[model samples]
Target: MSGATGTGTTMREAFVATAGHLLDEDPRVAVVLAAISADVFADAARRHPDRVIDVGIREQLLVGVAGGMALTGMRPIAHTYAPFLVERPFEQVKLDLGHQGVGAVLVSVGASYDWAAGGRTHHAPGDVALLDTLPGWTVHVPGHPDEVVDLLRRAARTDDRVYLRLTNDGNARAHPVGAGFQVLRTGRRAVVVAVGPVLDRVLAATARLDVTVLYASTVRPFDAVGLRAAVLAADRADVVLVEPYLAGTSTHAVAEALADVPHRVRALGVRRDVELRGYGEPADHDAAHGLDVAGIAARIHAFTRA
Candidate 1:
Protein backbone atom coordinates (compact mmCIF):
# COMPACT_ATOMS: atom_id res chain seq x y z
CA MET A 1 0.00 0.00 0.00
CA SER A 2 2.85 2.40 0.74
CA GLY A 3 3.50 3.17 -2.95
CA ALA A 4 6.50 5.50 -2.73
CA THR A 5 5.68 8.82 -1.00
CA GLY A 6 2.57 10.33 -2.70
CA THR A 7 2.00 7.41 -5.06
CA GLY A 8 -0.36 5.15 -3.09
CA THR A 9 -0.62 4.09 0.59
CA THR A 10 1.69 4.52 3.60
CA MET A 11 3.99 1.64 4.72
CA ARG A 12 2.45 1.59 8.19
CA GLU A 13 -0.96 1.21 6.58
CA ALA A 14 0.30 -1.69 4.48
CA PHE A 15 1.67 -3.37 7.61
CA VAL A 16 -1.75 -2.87 9.20
CA ALA A 17 -3.54 -4.27 6.19
CA THR A 18 -1.37 -7.38 6.11
CA ALA A 19 -1.68 -8.04 9.85
CA GLY A 20 -5.35 -7.11 10.06
CA HIS A 21 -6.45 -9.41 7.24
CA LEU A 22 -4.42 -12.30 8.65
CA LEU A 23 -5.86 -11.78 12.14
CA ASP A 24 -9.41 -11.73 10.86
CA GLU A 25 -8.91 -15.08 9.20
CA ASP A 26 -7.20 -16.71 12.20
CA PRO A 27 -8.08 -15.63 15.71
CA ARG A 28 -4.94 -17.50 16.72
CA VAL A 29 -2.67 -14.98 14.98
CA ALA A 30 -0.70 -13.77 17.99
CA VAL A 31 1.47 -10.67 17.40
CA VAL A 32 4.90 -10.30 19.03
CA LEU A 33 6.41 -7.03 17.84
CA ALA A 34 8.27 -4.11 19.46
CA ALA A 35 7.48 -0.51 20.48
CA ILE A 36 9.03 0.71 17.21
CA SER A 37 5.55 0.42 15.63
CA ALA A 38 3.52 -0.10 18.78
CA ASP A 39 0.56 1.99 17.62
CA VAL A 40 0.42 -0.02 14.42
CA PHE A 41 -0.19 -3.31 16.19
CA ALA A 42 -1.74 -1.91 19.39
CA ASP A 43 -5.31 -1.66 18.13
CA ALA A 44 -5.30 -5.28 17.13
CA ALA A 45 -3.62 -6.30 20.37
CA ARG A 46 -5.98 -4.16 22.44
CA ARG A 47 -8.89 -5.97 20.92
CA HIS A 48 -7.21 -9.33 21.40
CA PRO A 49 -4.85 -9.43 24.40
CA ASP A 50 -4.44 -13.16 24.07
CA ARG A 51 -3.10 -12.55 20.58
CA VAL A 52 -0.41 -9.91 21.26
CA ILE A 53 2.87 -10.35 23.11
CA ASP A 54 5.01 -7.21 23.59
CA VAL A 55 8.64 -7.68 24.63
CA GLY A 56 10.11 -4.22 24.61
CA ILE A 57 13.86 -3.73 23.94
CA ARG A 58 14.44 -7.42 24.33
CA GLU A 59 14.98 -8.77 20.86
CA GLN A 60 16.59 -12.03 21.96
CA LEU A 61 13.86 -12.69 24.51
CA LEU A 62 11.20 -11.70 22.00
CA VAL A 63 12.40 -14.17 19.36
CA GLY A 64 13.04 -16.94 21.87
CA VAL A 65 9.62 -16.40 23.38
CA ALA A 66 7.98 -16.36 19.97
CA GLY A 67 9.68 -19.67 19.15
CA GLY A 68 8.37 -21.09 22.38
CA MET A 69 4.90 -19.79 21.63
CA ALA A 70 4.98 -21.44 18.21
CA LEU A 71 5.98 -24.71 19.82
CA THR A 72 3.05 -24.38 22.17
CA GLY A 73 0.69 -23.94 19.16
CA MET A 74 0.37 -20.15 19.47
CA ARG A 75 1.00 -18.37 16.17
CA PRO A 76 3.26 -15.41 16.98
CA ILE A 77 4.55 -12.72 14.61
CA ALA A 78 7.54 -11.14 16.37
CA HIS A 79 8.64 -7.68 15.32
CA THR A 80 11.80 -5.65 16.04
CA TYR A 81 14.46 -3.44 14.53
CA ALA A 82 16.54 -5.35 11.97
CA PRO A 83 19.84 -4.78 13.79
CA PHE A 84 18.45 -5.82 17.14
CA LEU A 85 16.51 -8.73 15.71
CA VAL A 86 19.60 -10.30 14.18
CA GLU A 87 22.58 -8.74 15.93
CA ARG A 88 21.38 -8.34 19.47
CA PRO A 89 20.49 -11.99 19.69
CA PHE A 90 22.62 -13.72 17.11
CA GLU A 91 23.02 -16.85 19.22
CA GLN A 92 19.36 -17.02 20.16
CA VAL A 93 18.45 -16.67 16.50
CA LYS A 94 20.96 -19.33 15.40
CA LEU A 95 20.11 -21.82 18.12
CA ASP A 96 16.58 -21.10 19.32
CA LEU A 97 15.04 -20.30 15.95
CA GLY A 98 17.28 -21.70 13.20
CA HIS A 99 18.65 -24.89 14.75
CA GLN A 100 15.27 -25.83 16.18
CA GLY A 101 13.59 -25.06 12.83
CA VAL A 102 10.95 -22.73 14.23
CA GLY A 103 8.00 -21.98 11.91
CA ALA A 104 7.25 -18.36 12.92
CA VAL A 105 7.82 -15.27 10.77
CA LEU A 106 10.19 -12.46 11.83
CA VAL A 107 8.98 -9.10 10.51
CA SER A 108 11.99 -6.78 10.77
CA VAL A 109 11.96 -3.00 10.24
CA GLY A 110 14.97 -0.65 9.74
CA ALA A 111 16.35 -2.93 7.07
CA SER A 112 19.20 -1.61 4.91
CA TYR A 113 19.70 2.15 5.40
CA ASP A 114 16.18 2.71 6.70
CA TRP A 115 17.85 4.43 9.64
CA ALA A 116 19.04 7.90 8.72
CA ALA A 117 21.03 9.19 11.71
CA GLY A 118 21.64 5.93 13.52
CA GLY A 119 24.98 5.46 11.72
CA ARG A 120 26.66 2.13 10.90
CA THR A 121 25.93 0.76 14.38
CA HIS A 122 22.20 0.87 13.73
CA HIS A 123 22.24 -0.12 10.08
CA ALA A 124 21.37 -3.73 9.20
CA PRO A 125 23.17 -5.02 6.11
CA GLY A 126 24.24 -8.43 7.36
CA ASP A 127 20.77 -9.97 7.58
CA VAL A 128 20.84 -11.67 4.20
CA ALA A 129 24.14 -13.48 4.79
CA LEU A 130 23.27 -14.34 8.40
CA LEU A 131 19.75 -15.52 7.72
CA ASP A 132 20.62 -17.36 4.54
CA THR A 133 23.35 -19.39 6.27
CA LEU A 134 21.02 -20.58 8.99
CA PRO A 135 19.68 -23.99 8.08
CA GLY A 136 16.11 -24.21 6.79
CA TRP A 137 15.54 -20.44 6.78
CA THR A 138 13.67 -18.41 4.13
CA VAL A 139 14.50 -14.73 3.51
CA HIS A 140 12.39 -12.14 1.67
CA VAL A 141 13.59 -8.64 0.77
CA PRO A 142 10.49 -6.75 -0.34
CA GLY A 143 11.17 -3.75 -2.58
CA HIS A 144 8.20 -1.80 -1.23
CA PRO A 145 5.45 -1.86 1.35
CA ASP A 146 2.98 -3.51 -0.99
CA GLU A 147 5.39 -6.36 -1.53
CA VAL A 148 5.73 -6.60 2.23
CA VAL A 149 2.05 -7.46 2.53
CA ASP A 150 2.23 -9.87 -0.37
CA LEU A 151 5.24 -11.69 1.07
CA LEU A 152 3.53 -11.92 4.45
CA ARG A 153 0.59 -13.65 2.82
CA ARG A 154 2.91 -16.11 1.10
CA ALA A 155 4.71 -16.71 4.40
CA ALA A 156 1.44 -17.40 6.16
CA ARG A 157 0.55 -20.04 3.62
CA THR A 158 3.94 -21.75 3.65
CA ASP A 159 5.26 -24.21 6.26
CA ASP A 160 8.95 -23.09 6.43
CA ARG A 161 10.64 -20.56 8.71
CA VAL A 162 10.62 -16.95 7.33
CA TYR A 163 12.07 -13.47 7.83
CA LEU A 164 11.07 -10.28 5.94
CA ARG A 165 13.92 -7.75 5.45
CA LEU A 166 12.17 -4.40 5.98
CA THR A 167 13.04 -0.84 5.03
CA ASN A 168 10.90 2.12 6.04
CA ASP A 169 11.64 5.35 4.16
CA GLY A 170 9.10 7.02 6.42
CA ASN A 171 6.93 6.66 3.30
CA ALA A 172 5.24 3.81 1.47
CA ARG A 173 6.58 1.97 -1.56
CA ALA A 174 4.85 -0.83 -3.45
CA HIS A 175 6.25 -4.37 -3.96
CA PRO A 176 4.88 -7.51 -5.63
CA VAL A 177 4.74 -10.95 -4.04
CA GLY A 178 6.27 -14.26 -5.18
CA ALA A 179 9.12 -16.70 -4.41
CA GLY A 180 11.91 -14.87 -6.36
CA PHE A 181 12.99 -12.15 -8.80
CA GLN A 182 10.55 -10.41 -11.15
CA VAL A 183 11.77 -8.49 -14.19
CA LEU A 184 9.97 -5.16 -14.53
CA ARG A 185 11.38 -4.45 -17.99
CA THR A 186 13.37 -6.22 -20.73
CA GLY A 187 16.63 -5.39 -22.47
CA ARG A 188 18.93 -6.92 -25.06
CA ARG A 189 22.38 -6.47 -23.49
CA ALA A 190 22.13 -7.42 -19.82
CA VAL A 191 19.73 -8.12 -16.91
CA VAL A 192 19.87 -5.68 -13.96
CA VAL A 193 18.16 -6.82 -10.76
CA ALA A 194 17.86 -4.76 -7.56
CA VAL A 195 17.69 -6.07 -3.98
CA GLY A 196 16.85 -3.04 -1.81
CA PRO A 197 16.69 0.78 -2.01
CA VAL A 198 18.40 0.85 -5.39
CA LEU A 199 15.25 -0.37 -7.17
CA ASP A 200 14.32 3.25 -7.75
CA ARG A 201 17.70 3.93 -9.34
CA VAL A 202 17.49 0.76 -11.43
CA LEU A 203 14.16 1.90 -12.81
CA ALA A 204 15.65 5.25 -13.78
CA ALA A 205 18.74 3.65 -15.37
CA THR A 206 16.62 1.45 -17.64
CA ALA A 207 16.90 4.10 -20.36
CA ARG A 208 20.61 4.80 -19.82
CA LEU A 209 21.85 1.25 -20.40
CA ASP A 210 20.63 -1.40 -22.81
CA VAL A 211 19.59 -3.41 -19.77
CA THR A 212 16.48 -4.99 -18.28
CA VAL A 213 15.41 -4.26 -14.68
CA LEU A 214 14.48 -7.08 -12.30
CA TYR A 215 13.25 -6.77 -8.71
CA ALA A 216 14.47 -9.45 -6.27
CA SER A 217 12.24 -9.44 -3.17
CA THR A 218 12.89 -12.97 -2.08
CA VAL A 219 16.56 -13.11 -1.03
CA ARG A 220 16.99 -16.68 0.20
CA PRO A 221 15.22 -19.67 -1.23
CA PHE A 222 16.40 -17.86 -4.36
CA ASP A 223 14.75 -19.11 -7.51
CA ALA A 224 17.70 -20.53 -9.45
CA VAL A 225 15.18 -21.50 -12.07
CA GLY A 226 14.06 -17.89 -12.14
CA LEU A 227 17.64 -16.62 -12.50
CA ARG A 228 18.24 -19.09 -15.31
CA ALA A 229 15.05 -17.95 -16.99
CA ALA A 230 16.12 -14.31 -16.84
CA VAL A 231 19.48 -15.18 -18.37
CA LEU A 232 17.87 -17.27 -21.10
CA ALA A 233 15.29 -14.58 -21.75
CA ALA A 234 18.00 -11.97 -22.19
CA ASP A 235 19.55 -14.11 -24.95
CA ARG A 236 22.06 -15.36 -22.41
CA ALA A 237 22.95 -11.82 -21.43
CA ASP A 238 25.03 -10.96 -18.36
CA VAL A 239 23.09 -11.14 -15.08
CA VAL A 240 23.77 -9.13 -11.91
CA LEU A 241 22.10 -9.49 -8.50
CA VAL A 242 22.21 -6.26 -6.54
CA GLU A 243 22.16 -5.63 -2.79
CA PRO A 244 23.15 -2.97 -0.20
CA TYR A 245 24.47 -5.43 2.34
CA LEU A 246 28.21 -6.15 2.42
CA ALA A 247 28.33 -8.68 -0.41
CA GLY A 248 25.12 -10.36 0.74
CA THR A 249 23.75 -11.12 -2.72
CA SER A 250 24.69 -14.69 -3.49
CA THR A 251 26.65 -14.64 -6.76
CA HIS A 252 27.32 -18.31 -6.11
CA ALA A 253 23.61 -18.87 -5.57
CA VAL A 254 22.85 -17.40 -8.97
CA ALA A 255 25.96 -18.91 -10.59
CA GLU A 256 25.08 -22.40 -9.44
CA ALA A 257 21.54 -21.89 -10.66
CA LEU A 258 22.55 -20.72 -14.11
CA ALA A 259 25.80 -22.64 -14.61
CA ASP A 260 24.81 -23.74 -18.11
CA VAL A 261 24.01 -20.17 -19.21
CA PRO A 262 26.88 -18.45 -21.04
CA HIS A 263 27.14 -15.07 -19.31
CA ARG A 264 29.23 -13.32 -16.65
CA VAL A 265 27.55 -13.00 -13.22
CA ARG A 266 28.45 -10.43 -10.57
CA ALA A 267 26.79 -9.50 -7.26
CA LEU A 268 26.73 -5.85 -6.27
CA GLY A 269 26.62 -5.14 -2.54
CA VAL A 270 28.72 -3.05 -0.08
CA ARG A 271 32.35 -4.15 0.09
CA ARG A 272 33.45 -6.01 3.24
CA ASP A 273 35.35 -3.01 4.60
CA VAL A 274 35.43 0.64 3.50
CA GLU A 275 36.74 1.96 6.85
CA LEU A 276 33.76 4.27 7.18
CA ARG A 277 34.28 7.87 8.41
CA GLY A 278 33.00 8.06 11.99
CA TYR A 279 29.20 8.66 11.42
CA GLY A 280 26.16 9.87 9.46
CA GLU A 281 22.83 8.53 8.22
CA PRO A 282 22.93 5.01 6.81
CA ALA A 283 22.27 6.36 3.33
CA ASP A 284 25.14 8.83 3.48
CA HIS A 285 27.55 6.18 4.66
CA ASP A 286 26.32 3.83 1.96
CA ALA A 287 26.56 6.52 -0.68
CA ALA A 288 30.18 7.13 0.30
CA HIS A 289 30.91 3.49 -0.45
CA GLY A 290 28.99 3.45 -3.75
CA LEU A 291 25.88 1.76 -2.39
CA ASP A 292 23.41 4.37 -3.60
CA VAL A 293 21.30 4.23 -6.75
CA ALA A 294 23.72 6.15 -8.98
CA GLY A 295 26.58 3.86 -7.99
CA ILE A 296 24.38 0.81 -8.53
CA ALA A 297 23.35 1.99 -12.00
CA ALA A 298 26.96 2.62 -12.96
CA ARG A 299 28.01 -0.87 -11.90
CA ILE A 300 25.33 -2.53 -14.01
CA HIS A 301 26.48 -0.56 -17.03
CA ALA A 302 30.11 -1.58 -16.43
CA PHE A 303 29.17 -5.24 -16.49
CA THR A 304 27.59 -4.72 -19.91
CA ARG A 305 30.94 -3.50 -21.33
CA ALA A 306 32.88 -6.35 -19.71
Candidate 2:
Protein backbone atom coordinates (compact mmCIF):
# COMPACT_ATOMS: atom_id res chain seq x y z
CA MET A 1 0.00 0.00 0.00
CA SER A 2 2.90 2.33 0.65
CA GLY A 3 4.47 1.96 -2.80
CA ALA A 4 3.72 3.75 -6.09
CA THR A 5 0.10 4.85 -6.46
CA GLY A 6 -0.83 3.05 -9.64
CA THR A 7 2.07 4.36 -11.70
CA GLY A 8 1.92 3.50 -15.40
CA THR A 9 5.52 2.32 -15.38
CA THR A 10 6.11 -1.32 -16.27
CA MET A 11 7.79 -3.67 -13.82
CA ARG A 12 10.86 -4.04 -16.04
CA GLU A 13 11.45 -0.27 -16.20
CA ALA A 14 10.84 0.02 -12.47
CA PHE A 15 13.57 -2.56 -11.83
CA VAL A 16 16.14 -0.75 -14.02
CA ALA A 17 15.49 2.58 -12.33
CA THR A 18 15.43 1.11 -8.82
CA ALA A 19 18.55 -0.95 -9.54
CA GLY A 20 20.44 2.11 -10.76
CA HIS A 21 19.41 3.88 -7.56
CA LEU A 22 20.65 0.94 -5.52
CA LEU A 23 24.01 1.07 -7.29
CA ASP A 24 24.27 4.74 -6.36
CA GLU A 25 23.11 4.28 -2.76
CA ASP A 26 24.40 0.83 -1.72
CA PRO A 27 28.08 0.17 -2.19
CA ARG A 28 27.64 -3.54 -1.56
CA VAL A 29 25.05 -3.88 -4.32
CA ALA A 30 26.28 -5.24 -7.66
CA VAL A 31 24.37 -5.96 -10.88
CA VAL A 32 25.17 -8.81 -13.29
CA LEU A 33 23.42 -8.97 -16.62
CA ALA A 34 23.47 -11.30 -19.66
CA ALA A 35 22.99 -8.62 -22.33
CA ILE A 36 19.24 -8.49 -21.70
CA SER A 37 19.14 -4.97 -20.30
CA ALA A 38 22.69 -3.88 -20.90
CA ASP A 39 21.57 -0.83 -22.86
CA VAL A 40 19.37 0.33 -20.00
CA PHE A 41 22.20 -0.12 -17.50
CA ALA A 42 24.81 1.41 -19.79
CA ASP A 43 24.75 4.70 -17.86
CA ALA A 44 24.95 2.92 -14.50
CA ALA A 45 27.67 0.66 -15.88
CA ARG A 46 29.62 3.79 -16.78
CA ARG A 47 29.06 5.23 -13.30
CA HIS A 48 29.91 2.09 -11.28
CA PRO A 49 32.08 0.19 -13.72
CA ASP A 50 33.23 -2.17 -10.98
CA ARG A 51 29.84 -3.09 -9.55
CA VAL A 52 27.82 -3.14 -12.80
CA ILE A 53 28.82 -6.07 -15.00
CA ASP A 54 27.54 -7.33 -18.35
CA VAL A 55 28.60 -10.89 -19.11
CA GLY A 56 27.58 -10.79 -22.77
CA ILE A 57 25.23 -13.73 -23.59
CA ARG A 58 26.57 -16.17 -21.03
CA GLU A 59 23.74 -16.86 -18.56
CA GLN A 60 25.64 -19.63 -16.80
CA LEU A 61 28.42 -17.14 -16.16
CA LEU A 62 25.85 -14.52 -15.25
CA VAL A 63 24.82 -16.53 -12.21
CA GLY A 64 28.36 -17.83 -11.70
CA VAL A 65 29.72 -14.32 -11.50
CA ALA A 66 26.97 -13.39 -9.09
CA GLY A 67 27.85 -16.35 -6.89
CA GLY A 68 31.50 -15.32 -6.98
CA MET A 69 30.51 -11.79 -5.96
CA ALA A 70 28.42 -13.12 -3.12
CA LEU A 71 31.44 -15.05 -1.91
CA THR A 72 33.12 -11.69 -1.50
CA GLY A 73 30.21 -10.51 0.69
CA MET A 74 28.47 -8.54 -2.07
CA ARG A 75 24.78 -8.73 -2.88
CA PRO A 76 24.53 -9.27 -6.63
CA ILE A 77 21.38 -8.55 -8.64
CA ALA A 78 21.26 -10.83 -11.67
CA HIS A 79 18.84 -9.93 -14.48
CA THR A 80 17.77 -11.50 -17.78
CA TYR A 81 14.80 -13.00 -19.58
CA ALA A 82 12.91 -15.69 -17.68
CA PRO A 83 13.98 -18.78 -19.63
CA PHE A 84 17.58 -17.64 -19.94
CA LEU A 85 17.87 -16.67 -16.30
CA VAL A 86 16.15 -19.64 -14.63
CA GLU A 87 15.92 -22.51 -17.11
CA ARG A 88 19.11 -22.26 -19.19
CA PRO A 89 21.44 -22.01 -16.20
CA PHE A 90 19.35 -23.96 -13.71
CA GLU A 91 22.29 -26.16 -12.78
CA GLN A 92 24.39 -23.10 -12.17
CA VAL A 93 21.62 -21.64 -10.06
CA LYS A 94 21.33 -24.90 -8.12
CA LEU A 95 25.06 -25.29 -7.54
CA ASP A 96 26.59 -21.83 -7.80
CA LEU A 97 24.01 -20.22 -5.55
CA GLY A 98 21.93 -22.91 -3.85
CA HIS A 99 24.60 -25.53 -3.22
CA GLN A 100 27.27 -23.00 -2.37
CA GLY A 101 24.84 -21.39 0.09
CA VAL A 102 25.52 -17.86 -1.11
CA GLY A 103 22.92 -15.14 -1.47
CA ALA A 104 22.07 -13.10 -4.61
CA VAL A 105 19.01 -11.44 -6.09
CA LEU A 106 17.82 -13.19 -9.27
CA VAL A 107 15.39 -10.88 -11.06
CA SER A 108 13.55 -12.08 -14.17
CA VAL A 109 11.25 -10.50 -16.76
CA GLY A 110 8.89 -12.03 -19.41
CA ALA A 111 6.62 -14.01 -17.12
CA SER A 112 5.66 -17.39 -18.53
CA TYR A 113 5.04 -16.39 -22.17
CA ASP A 114 5.06 -12.65 -22.04
CA TRP A 115 6.97 -12.72 -25.27
CA ALA A 116 4.45 -14.91 -27.02
CA ALA A 117 6.11 -14.19 -30.34
CA GLY A 118 9.41 -15.43 -28.92
CA GLY A 119 7.80 -18.91 -28.79
CA ARG A 120 8.30 -21.79 -26.36
CA THR A 121 12.07 -21.42 -26.01
CA HIS A 122 11.51 -17.97 -24.55
CA HIS A 123 8.73 -19.19 -22.26
CA ALA A 124 9.42 -20.25 -18.65
CA PRO A 125 6.29 -21.36 -16.87
CA GLY A 126 8.26 -23.95 -14.93
CA ASP A 127 10.78 -21.56 -13.42
CA VAL A 128 9.11 -21.47 -10.02
CA ALA A 129 8.52 -25.21 -10.03
CA LEU A 130 12.19 -25.81 -10.81
CA LEU A 131 13.33 -23.40 -8.12
CA ASP A 132 11.10 -25.23 -5.63
CA THR A 133 13.53 -28.12 -5.94
CA LEU A 134 16.08 -26.01 -4.06
CA PRO A 135 15.84 -25.05 -0.43
CA GLY A 136 16.26 -21.63 1.26
CA TRP A 137 15.14 -19.59 -1.75
CA THR A 138 12.71 -16.68 -1.43
CA VAL A 139 10.54 -16.24 -4.54
CA HIS A 140 8.70 -12.98 -5.26
CA VAL A 141 6.17 -12.55 -8.12
CA PRO A 142 5.35 -8.86 -7.89
CA GLY A 143 2.01 -7.75 -9.45
CA HIS A 144 2.71 -4.04 -9.74
CA PRO A 145 5.62 -1.70 -10.48
CA ASP A 146 5.12 -0.26 -7.00
CA GLU A 147 5.48 -3.72 -5.50
CA VAL A 148 8.51 -4.27 -7.72
CA VAL A 149 10.17 -1.10 -6.35
CA ASP A 150 9.54 -2.22 -2.77
CA LEU A 151 10.50 -5.88 -3.30
CA LEU A 152 13.73 -5.00 -5.13
CA ARG A 153 14.75 -2.70 -2.29
CA ARG A 154 14.16 -5.48 0.25
CA ALA A 155 16.03 -8.02 -1.88
CA ALA A 156 18.94 -5.67 -2.52
CA ARG A 157 19.17 -4.79 1.16
CA THR A 158 19.88 -8.39 2.08
CA ASP A 159 22.09 -11.20 0.80
CA ASP A 160 19.34 -13.76 0.59
CA ARG A 161 18.83 -16.10 -2.38
CA VAL A 162 15.78 -14.40 -3.89
CA TYR A 163 14.05 -14.66 -7.29
CA LEU A 164 11.94 -11.64 -8.13
CA ARG A 165 9.77 -12.62 -11.12
CA LEU A 166 8.89 -9.53 -13.20
CA THR A 167 6.20 -9.62 -15.83
CA ASN A 168 4.38 -7.54 -18.46
CA ASP A 169 1.15 -8.28 -16.61
CA GLY A 170 0.37 -6.35 -13.43
CA ASN A 171 -2.49 -5.46 -11.12
CA ALA A 172 -4.26 -2.09 -11.05
CA ARG A 173 -2.96 -1.56 -7.51
CA ALA A 174 -0.39 -3.04 -5.20
CA HIS A 175 -0.78 -4.34 -1.69
CA PRO A 176 1.82 -3.76 1.01
CA VAL A 177 4.95 -5.91 0.97
CA GLY A 178 4.44 -8.86 3.33
CA ALA A 179 5.24 -12.55 3.54
CA GLY A 180 1.58 -13.46 4.21
CA PHE A 181 -1.42 -12.92 1.96
CA GLN A 182 -3.50 -9.73 2.01
CA VAL A 183 -7.26 -10.13 1.92
CA LEU A 184 -8.89 -7.80 -0.57
CA ARG A 185 -12.45 -9.06 -0.36
CA THR A 186 -14.17 -11.34 2.18
CA GLY A 187 -16.89 -13.85 1.57
CA ARG A 188 -18.20 -17.01 3.25
CA ARG A 189 -18.37 -19.19 0.16
CA ALA A 190 -14.75 -19.80 -0.89
CA VAL A 191 -11.26 -18.31 -0.91
CA VAL A 192 -9.45 -17.26 -4.09
CA VAL A 193 -5.68 -16.81 -3.89
CA ALA A 194 -4.41 -14.49 -6.66
CA VAL A 195 -0.67 -14.50 -7.18
CA GLY A 196 1.15 -11.50 -8.70
CA PRO A 197 -0.20 -9.78 -11.83
CA VAL A 198 -3.30 -11.97 -12.04
CA LEU A 199 -5.10 -10.23 -9.17
CA ASP A 200 -6.99 -7.79 -11.37
CA ARG A 201 -8.09 -10.54 -13.71
CA VAL A 202 -9.11 -12.76 -10.81
CA LEU A 203 -11.11 -9.93 -9.29
CA ALA A 204 -12.91 -9.33 -12.57
CA ALA A 205 -13.50 -13.06 -13.03
CA THR A 206 -14.96 -13.41 -9.56
CA ALA A 207 -16.61 -10.04 -9.19
CA ARG A 208 -20.09 -11.52 -8.96
CA LEU A 209 -19.11 -14.53 -6.88
CA ASP A 210 -19.22 -14.61 -3.10
CA VAL A 211 -15.67 -15.55 -2.18
CA THR A 212 -12.63 -14.21 -0.33
CA VAL A 213 -9.81 -12.85 -2.50
CA LEU A 214 -6.26 -12.92 -1.14
CA TYR A 215 -3.33 -11.27 -2.93
CA ALA A 216 0.14 -12.78 -2.65
CA SER A 217 3.36 -11.26 -4.04
CA THR A 218 5.86 -13.16 -1.91
CA VAL A 219 4.98 -16.77 -2.71
CA ARG A 220 8.15 -18.79 -1.97
CA PRO A 221 7.52 -18.59 1.73
CA PHE A 222 4.02 -19.75 0.93
CA ASP A 223 1.83 -18.21 3.64
CA ALA A 224 0.25 -21.41 4.94
CA VAL A 225 -0.78 -19.83 8.22
CA GLY A 226 -2.50 -16.98 6.42
CA LEU A 227 -4.15 -19.40 3.99
CA ARG A 228 -5.40 -21.61 6.80
CA ALA A 229 -6.71 -18.62 8.70
CA ALA A 230 -8.57 -17.39 5.61
CA VAL A 231 -10.06 -20.83 5.00
CA LEU A 232 -11.17 -21.18 8.62
CA ALA A 233 -12.66 -17.71 8.61
CA ALA A 234 -14.51 -18.30 5.35
CA ASP A 235 -16.12 -21.49 6.81
CA ARG A 236 -16.08 -23.12 3.36
CA ALA A 237 -13.00 -25.16 2.53
CA ASP A 238 -13.16 -24.80 -1.23
CA VAL A 239 -10.05 -22.88 -2.33
CA VAL A 240 -9.00 -21.67 -5.77
CA LEU A 241 -5.42 -20.73 -6.65
CA VAL A 242 -4.77 -18.51 -9.70
CA GLU A 243 -1.13 -17.89 -10.56
CA PRO A 244 0.66 -16.41 -13.55
CA TYR A 245 3.10 -19.29 -13.98
CA LEU A 246 2.72 -23.01 -14.56
CA ALA A 247 -0.61 -24.34 -13.38
CA GLY A 248 -0.61 -26.28 -10.13
CA THR A 249 2.95 -25.10 -9.36
CA SER A 250 1.74 -24.27 -5.87
CA THR A 251 -0.87 -27.01 -5.59
CA HIS A 252 1.33 -29.14 -3.34
CA ALA A 253 2.00 -26.12 -1.16
CA VAL A 254 -1.72 -25.48 -0.90
CA ALA A 255 -2.35 -29.12 -0.06
CA GLU A 256 0.33 -29.05 2.63
CA ALA A 257 -1.05 -25.84 4.06
CA LEU A 258 -4.56 -27.26 4.43
CA ALA A 259 -3.44 -30.82 5.14
CA ASP A 260 -5.25 -31.15 8.46
CA VAL A 261 -8.46 -29.67 7.14
CA PRO A 262 -10.76 -31.18 4.53
CA HIS A 263 -10.39 -28.88 1.58
CA ARG A 264 -10.66 -28.84 -2.22
CA VAL A 265 -8.28 -26.73 -4.31
CA ARG A 266 -8.51 -25.80 -8.00
CA ALA A 267 -5.22 -24.62 -9.46
CA LEU A 268 -5.31 -22.39 -12.53
CA GLY A 269 -2.53 -20.82 -14.65
CA VAL A 270 -0.34 -21.62 -17.66
CA ARG A 271 -0.89 -25.25 -18.61
CA ARG A 272 1.74 -27.98 -18.81
CA ASP A 273 -0.26 -30.50 -20.77
CA VAL A 274 0.44 -28.90 -24.17
CA GLU A 275 2.79 -26.24 -25.50
CA LEU A 276 1.07 -23.40 -27.33
CA ARG A 277 2.60 -23.35 -30.79
CA GLY A 278 1.13 -20.19 -32.25
CA TYR A 279 2.77 -16.78 -31.89
CA GLY A 280 0.26 -14.24 -30.68
CA GLU A 281 -0.25 -11.73 -27.91
CA PRO A 282 0.06 -12.71 -24.22
CA ALA A 283 -3.75 -12.47 -24.08
CA ASP A 284 -3.94 -15.24 -26.66
CA HIS A 285 -1.84 -17.47 -24.44
CA ASP A 286 -3.99 -16.57 -21.45
CA ALA A 287 -7.11 -17.57 -23.32
CA ALA A 288 -5.50 -20.76 -24.53
CA HIS A 289 -4.63 -21.63 -20.94
CA GLY A 290 -8.02 -20.59 -19.55
CA LEU A 291 -6.51 -17.68 -17.62
CA ASP A 292 -8.46 -14.82 -19.18
CA VAL A 293 -11.28 -13.25 -17.19
CA ALA A 294 -14.04 -15.14 -18.97
CA GLY A 295 -12.15 -18.40 -18.93
CA ILE A 296 -11.37 -17.93 -15.25
CA ALA A 297 -14.97 -17.14 -14.40
CA ALA A 298 -16.21 -20.22 -16.22
CA ARG A 299 -13.62 -22.44 -14.58
CA ILE A 300 -14.39 -21.02 -11.17
CA HIS A 301 -18.10 -21.54 -11.70
CA ALA A 302 -17.56 -25.13 -12.75
CA PHE A 303 -15.17 -25.87 -9.90
CA THR A 304 -17.33 -24.31 -7.20
CA ARG A 305 -20.42 -25.95 -8.57
CA ALA A 306 -18.77 -29.35 -8.67
Each model's RMSD to truth, in Å? Answer: 2.7, 2.1
- Candidate 1 structure lDDT: 0.71
**Model 1: ten consecutive residues of lowest lDDT:** 1-10
Give the poorly placed runs of model 2, Cα more than 4 Å off: 1-7
Q: Residue 90's C-alpha lDDT in candidate 1?
A: 80
Total colliding residue pairs, candidate 2: 1
Candidate 1 regions off by >4 Å?
Answer: 1-8, 170-175, 235-237
How much is the lDDT of residue 190 in candidate 1? Answer: 79
Candidate 1 lDDT over residue span 1-306, tens digit each: 123546565455676678877877876577786566777777787777777777787788888987887777666677777888887888888877667766788888777656656776677777778776677878877666777777888787655678877765422355656776777787778777687456775676556777777777776777787767777877545877677576745877877887766668767776776656456766676677666667776777777887
C-alpha local distance difference test of each model: 0.71, 0.92
Summarize candidate 2's per-residue lDDT along 1-306 as a digit string, tens digits: 111345567889899999999999999999999999999999999999999999999999999999999999999999999999999999999999988999999999888988899988899999999999999999999988988999999998887999999988887787798899999999888999999889888999999988999999999999999999999998689999999899999999999999999999999988889988898999899999999999999999888777
In candidate 1, the residue pairs with backbone N, CA or C atoms under 3 Å apart (3 or more residues apart, or in different chains) clash, namely 2-9, 2-172, 2-173, 4-172, 4-173, 116-281, 147-175
